[model samples]
Target chain A: MVDLTHTLSPEFPFLPVEGKTFPFRSSPIATIKGDGVYANRWELTEHVGTHLDAPCHFAEGAMAIEAIPLETLFVPLAVVSIAERVATNPDTTLGAGDLMRWEKDHGEIPARAAVFLHTGWDVRTKEPGAFVNMDGAKTMRFPGFSDKAIEFLLGRRSISGIGIDTLSIDPGRDKEYAVHKELFRAGKWAVECVANLSRVPATGAFVFVAPVKVAGASGAPARIVAVW
Target chain B: MVDLTHTLSPEFPFLPVEGKTFPFRSSPIATIKGDGVYANRWELTEHVGTHLDAPCHFAEGAMAIEAIPLETLFVPLAVVSIAERVATNPDTTLGAGDLMRWEKDHGEIPARAAVFLHTGWDVRTKEPGAFVNMDGAKTMRFPGFSDKAIEFLLGRRSISGIGIDTLSIDPGRDKEYAVHKELFRAGKWAVECVANLSRVPATGAFVFVAPVKVAGASGAPARIVAVW
Candidate 1:
């Protein structure tokens, strides 16, 4: 089994917010000095660190994180590496052609499987500024799937969801978040900020995306693992 | 796969604290009506609802939630039902005798396997006061593993950890929290407030306790599931 989740901490960057960003605070709720026990309270956003974005994140009245089927959370994993391209162009978006090329080597992506885009961005997770990659104009930049790519994955392959090492399934520069809408509209979910994808084989790994079961919430932090 | 986690919400009871208790507050960070996206932020304790108790939760310099081994997180599950006793006497604790009886029916508890105690306490999870079951002196009463049972499991069987359907693995009335200390000192973990243990067979199921990967934190909320 390989852990495909980033350890959530205060340093893990949150998506740029206009008003109030989600907070991740950890304080000792009980300490050995006072309470004779050691425990903590974590107050954070549902989307902190490695997380799952349920359909409700984009589509109103859609299934929340709790409503996601247990069977769908565990699926065959298909990883497509685009690290080389992302190394040069941070705005690199995975296209349908990339999927076709990967299929040539890894066979067809099975139905109801999860497709993860490995841009090697997880290496920068420890450096919050680099992970977020905000430009001079304050616009973030990162790799994500193209709208056409997501549409193809949904319409042709019937995928359960898509995952990425970056903060979003859509490129940070995307103002409309087209990929998110396209995927969520198809009743699919997204797993973001996944770590250690390079350790997993391109095919044949079973991914477990276990999200904190927040009732009726749009999304929640998740612990993702892969077993072969 | 059976979901052994409860739906986390504001109504769910939190562990009583001297100053403040578990506060589950969720608000829309971005709404479709305003921001063209539906997202929310949540603030709560790491021990809220169904969660894993990392070794650091009790023992200093011990493994935090992120440091728990993946192999230990997934293991053979052994369910021991004491629902009848717990129904009549809420303070009933699982003792070494219970483990012996369970082994009598099934085989010996396997090494590094997770044992679950089903006390039928999940039925009260919806009722805040009933789940806490605080007496007149403000002492909470619930079923948990006794020190003898934990010692037997750790020393004799060399089990991975134990889980309970109550708010904690230690009976709420115990001030010393001896069970927690013993398990943590042995480098074992605990899954607390798990739901739907009755759905899983007494043996033969593989339990997955996937906690939110809070870096260096004592514990975190988990999504526990069992596959048969």
Candidate 2:
């Protein structure tokens, strides 16, 4: 079993929204000394850290996080590595060609599969700013799925969702969020900022993309794992 | 696949704390009208809904939510139903003799299994006040595991955790929480307020008790699932 989730906390940098975002924060709510048990209260934006963006995140009147069928959350895991290219050009993406190449080596992307774009971006998570890769404070640049790749998966394959080791399904500089709209428009979910995509192989593992079962929320921090 | 998680929200009744508990609350942080995408900020206490209680929840220096290994979270599931007894005696417990009867009928309780006490309490979820079954103003009447049953599983059987359909692993009326301390003392976790235990068979299902990967928190809302 491999945990693909980041340890969400206030320290984890956020995809900036007007120079600020509600990062994950924890406060002591109970203690063994007083309440006979230790517990906490948390406040966080639904999209922070390793999380699943429900279709409702962009598609109005779509499935909320709780409405997603449990069977859909359990999918065949497929990792498409663009890490080698990303090492050289930080703006790399998992394109349609990359998916075809993966199929050539493995097999066809299986039905109800979650294809994760592995950009080796997980390494950048050690530093707050590097993970988002904000260049000169103007536009953030990191790897994501190309629009063509998303269309191919939705139109050609039988996948349940797509995931990435970056902040958003669209490239960091994509102000329009083309990929988020495309995927959510199909009523599919997206997993962003996954921690350990490298540890998983190209195919064969069963993945569980589970978010906190928050009723009617856009997204929530998720604990993603793969078991072979 | 069965989702053994309740939809967490403000309307869901919490395990009342004094006059109030920090119930799961969501506020729109972004929207298609304002931020070009829908999103919400959530505030929740760790133990309010379907959740996992880490060993550190009671024991001072035990595992926090993040420290629990992914391998440990995946275990064989065993549902021990006390619903028949609970129909009449709402405070009925799954005791040591119950384990003996279960093993007799279904064979031995396997190693590293999650034995869930199914009290058929999920049907009461339609009315929040009825689910916890607070007896007037005195106690909350609900089924849980006996200390003998917990110790039997801990000392005799090699198990990962114990779970209950009720609000806690110890009966709600037992304010001292004896079962919680006994289980956590041996570094075992607990899954409380699970949604659907009766749906799972007596054995053969693999369980995933996953909580939000909140850094250094005692517990968090969990999305528990079973695949038979």
Candidate 3:
């Protein structure tokens, strides 16, 4: 049993959007002397941390959290670690060849599996500057998917979704977000900000990426877990 | 595999508060979109819909969402259905006697198992009005646990936590919230607003309730599933 979701708090570094202010604050709902009790009060964006992006985030009429089938959310999973490669190049993008090599080393990715790309990117979460990687140009730098990699997964593999350790499935410099377009167009989902992938076995575990049944929203925070 | 979470939407009701109001309403992120996108933007109180309450919800310095051990969150579960009784009384509360009778029918609840109480209360979710149950008095009436049931579960069972099909673990009319205190004091967590427990067997299914890793959060929306 391993928890792959990241902890969401006020301290969790959020995605920096230029010009627009991000709502990322959470306060404890204090108890009144004569009133009732309910503990926390959260005031933040839907996509704060460890969240899932629905097609509607980019493409309209895509599947939202509630409409995604339960079977698609819970499936067999395979974790392919590219930590060493990502450690060397923060802007590194994983491609199909990389995943093929991973499959060669581990085993075939089963049908209906969630292919998790473990880049060891989450270790830097505590260091806000490093995690978000805000540069002088105001653009961020993070390891993500190569356009070809996403295409390969959807076109060739029998997969339900792809998960990554970084904030976005596409590189920070990717303004087009081609990877997201491909995955969403293919009727698949993406899980982001996953942690502790190193703790999971390469295969034989079931992944549960249950997002909130938020109606008509583009995306929602998901609490993903892997059951062995 | 059937999903048991309520869809959180703009129309999905939340616990009311006596505070200054705003004309602009931020809609909840719709969970499912077509063509493989789900919830791009979600807005809700942490305690809304299908959620898990950590001990830190009321017991400060206690376990936060991330601090609770994975073993505690991912244990084997036992479903104890009180739906038949709840059908007669919407305010029916589960007590020790109910649990004892359940044991006779389904055998003893194992130590550290997640005890899910299925009250058939979720039928109202199809219609928002009955789901929130806001009447002229503004008080919600729903099935939940009696204080005595809370004491019995904590004192007699080495259970991981309790799950309920209603909006809260306590009766909506509960003023003191003794159930919350009793469970939190014992370092137990909760799964609320769960559905489809009636589809699962009374025992043998494993309940997975993994919430977003919210730091110091009393609770967060959880993606719950059952594997038989």
**Candidate 2 CAPRI assessment class:** medium
Q: How far does residue A54 in candidate 2 sit from its true spot (Å)?
A: 0.9
lDDT of 1 by residue, A1-228 (tens): 999998888888878686757547888778867777787777677777999999988898888999999999999999999999998999999999999999999999988899999999999988888999999999899999998898789878978889999999999998898898888888889999999999999999999999999888988999999999
lDDT of 2: 0.87
Ranking by TM-score: 1, 2, 3
Interface RMSD (Å), every candidate: 1.2, 1.5, 4.5
Residues B64-120 of candidate 2 have per-residue lDDT tens digits of 989987877899998999899999998788889999999999999988888888999
- Supply candidate 2's per-residue lDDT for A85: 96
Q: Between the candidate structures 1 and 3, which one is better when assessed by DockQ? A: 1
Write candidate 3's Cα lDDT for B1-228 as tens digits.
Answer: 667777765555555555621111254333234323233333346787788988866665677788888888767788887788777777788889998888898888888899888888787777767866765788888878898887887888889999988878888877677898789888999888888888888888887777877776778878788888
Rank order (by lDDT, best first): 1, 2, 3
lDDT of each: 0.89, 0.87, 0.77
Q: Cα lDDT of model 1 overall?
A: 0.89
| Per-residue lDDT of model 1, residues B1-228, tens digit only | 899999999888888887756557787778888888888777787788899999988898889988899999989999999998987898889999999999999999877799999999998998989999999999999989999999889878978888998988999898888999999999999988899998999999999999999888888889999998
Q: Cα RMSD to native, each candidate?
A: 1.2, 1.4, 3.4
Please identify which of the two predictions, 2 or 3, would achieve the higher TM-score against the true structure.
2
TM-score of chain B of each: 0.98, 0.96, 0.88
- Cα lDDT of candidate 3 equals 0.77
